[model samples]
Target: MSAWRWLVTITRDSRSFFFTFATLCGVVPGVIGYGVMQVTNSTNPELEARLRKSARPETVMMGKVNQERLAEYLGELKQKQDTNDRYVAALRGETLTRKPYQRIQPVPKPSDTVTTKAQ
Candidate 1:
């Protein structure tokens, strides 16, 4: 029988068609993916070592807190709190004399005239 005739015959029966369709769409691709994974899979020793090192906990305990770092952190916290407070006050319709937050000014670019003079 011709290939097309055989395919028509198989498709006529629901059970046979389902088995054929499942094998073609599911099993075939699964087998192909398995083969590809097996062929392409590889291990890197350096990457493995790095992964192991990161996974392992640090042996050394944190030393005494540095007073300078603590002070700097506290100052940053205070600044953040002040900014948040100013934002909340503004939301409540309070008039702020000073700017809530300082805006970052763009750096002045060298003019074409300056570049021409330098050249």
Candidate 2:
């Protein structure tokens, strides 16, 4: 009949103890948080005005095509294709030609020096 005795009895069974613990720790807090969120949630007038303004027909317009960006993207695709071709050539044991845009310069090896003294 006492709360302490009821808790002791519930803890004796694993299934009842698990369900009681889950209900108390998980389900109870989740329900309380949902209730609090619902009570506290309210629409802001300024946000509503901004949303209405953005949703107006005058604020919407057709996207303009950028010719420069399109040209740059095409150039990038061509460069990528050229790089893949170079890689394929290298894999086939063929010499790869450097692109005009690339500024790679080969470094020259230092010559060996030898000195002999007359006895």
Q: Quick one: best TM-score, which candidate? A: 1
Residues 1-119, model 1: lDDT tens digits: 69978777777777878687868989889999999999887687888677666662442122223554466447758777444644565576553332337322233466789889889
Q: What is the overall TM-score of model 1 with all chains considered together?
A: 0.31
Candidate 1 local lDDT, residue 111: 79
Candidate 2 lDDT over 46-110, as tens digits, reads 98778767774644432123454456447758777444654455566554223556523334344
Clashes of each: 0, 0
Show model 2 residue runs off by greater than 4 Å.
Answer: 47-119
- Evaluated at residue 103, the lDDT of candidate 2 is 28
lDDT of 1 at 86: 44
Candidate 1 — number of clashing residue pairs?
A: 0
TM-score for each predicted model, relative to the true structure: 0.31, 0.30
Error of 1 at 33 (Å): 1.4
What are the lDDT scores of the predictions, listed in order? Answer: 0.62, 0.62
